[model samples]
Target: MPGPIWTSPAPPGNPAARRAPPAGRFRSWWNSCCKGRAEPSRHTGGIVAPERVDFYVLNQADDASRLGYACMIAAKAWRQGHRVYMQVDTPGEAEALDRMLWEYQAASFIPHARTGTPEAALSPVLIGTECAPEKWRGMLVSLTRALPEGAAECRRVADLIADSQDHRAAGRERFRAYRAMGVEPGTHEIRL
Candidate 1:
């Protein structure tokens, strides 16, 4: 079965009055939701939740370079003991990423499988063109133009943005989407 679709409650002070609870309340609620498996936050004394979204702006305009960085990010996250979901825009891109992950670095190995594969459930990293994994609630790395579905359930989300005008525009739109979801995503300017 598919996971639930998460949407942010409307902001406070709106006429609709459908806002989410205050941050403190939300944190407590999240802790209760995670119950025994919650990780404590480093910045806050509360439990860690799916509130952090990061936008990476790459200096290169080539898609290959962007994908290389995605591989690097995925490998790093995997080494840190975090499962990852790498969402691409198309099946061709997903296949290309699956091939590249094996040879992206000379010394690094990121154990991964594409979505729907029998091994995907056991892999530390998963790559797919559509539909986020239902059980692996970890980091999400989006190489697509739009934000991947089910990102609200991830511990963290990374949107890879190329350094072209069009790409930047699309990234901005995604940034707005994150904000709309009540997450103020951090921005990182990458030199590569």
Candidate 2:
């Protein structure tokens, strides 16, 4: 499958540019997530009200490596007793990750179920192309170029950026969008 092109504010003439949710809806989502807690910001020199999001830039360029790293992160989070949501761009990617989690590491096992599955509510990890704030929480591992809906409700959001020019550019756009939304997103550069 071709990698996703991530651009925010959608470049002119690009039909795939994602339109953000309406301001009212976005504000409601943000409010519900933050619950009026003010987050401290060093750059702004004042309290900024927004949920935290993290962007991970992988050193490997292949899809397998990116998905593997995502699994690693999700496994770690699950072990830490946090519910995890692994958001992909398509159902195929979701299925691929589901298969990967079972065998990604020989000695490790991460309990996960696809969204809408009967076991998803009880599983520590839920994989899907969309977010389910009501069922999934804790950490969100986003594999898509665009920010997954309802990300603000999660305790932390991780946007994975593959080692490719297009992926990096899209990651930057996501970073900008998060910042604009008053959320400070940290970048993680993965060496492996």
Candidate 3:
């Protein structure tokens, strides 16, 4: 089991909730994690890059485009045989994503369910408001301003930045947070 990670938001004025664990302590958890994953590497990582992370820079900041791209990304990953969890900030976003995934492509559909449902465990993709569920930690596509919880345990985390001032600011904060978590995140520009 892994020690507690500050993956979610604490109510305002709760300083401890916002504070992250020390670097050495966090690294220790990653090294000793027994999640049936491959043998631990002697180096400061595993088979993949340390907490592999990627940020997608979007040209348009509109909700439609953001959800569309997220749907596409989730579909591609699912087709490639990787389970994905789409983390949204609230129940409304979760519902929006669930509906968008269904109608994203007229010729195809992406199988998915909300986090608490029975189908979520077996579905290739899951959309949820929370982020710490062990089963949904394979790959995370976060559509929230704050980084989702349990991100350190995920094999890969995909964050998005829409073309808006607020989005950019939030993206910068997450970029810095990822660095603090010992990950050198990769970046990609989405033309559409």
Quantify all predictions' global Cα lDDT against the true fold.
Answer: 0.76, 0.75, 0.77
State residue 28's C-alpha deviation in candidate 1, in Å: 22
Clashing pairs in 2: none
Name the regions of candidate 1 deviating beyond 4 angstroms. Answer: 1-49
Candidate 3 overall lDDT versus native: 0.77
Q: What is the lDDT of residue 55 in candidate 2?
A: 81
Per-residue CA lDDT of model 2 for 1-192, tens digit only, reads: 996675465565676555643334543212232222234444444634235687888899998999999999888777766677889989999989999999898987889999888997788789998765555655678898786776655656778999999899988887887787678788888988
TM-score of 2: 0.72
| Per-residue lDDT of candidate 3, residues 1-192 (tens digit) | 996555545544577666745444434212322232343323335432235688999999798899999998788778766678889899998888999998999999889999879887788788988864676566788899987776766767788889999999999998998787668898999999
**What's the true lDDT of residue 87 in model 3?**
90
Q: List the residue pairs that clash in candidate 1.
A: 10-19
TM-score of 3: 0.75
lDDT of 2 at 102: 91
Our tally of clashes for model 2 stands at 0
Residues 36-59 of candidate 1 have per-residue lDDT tens digits of 224544433353435577899999
Model 1 weakest 10-residue run by lDDT: 28-37
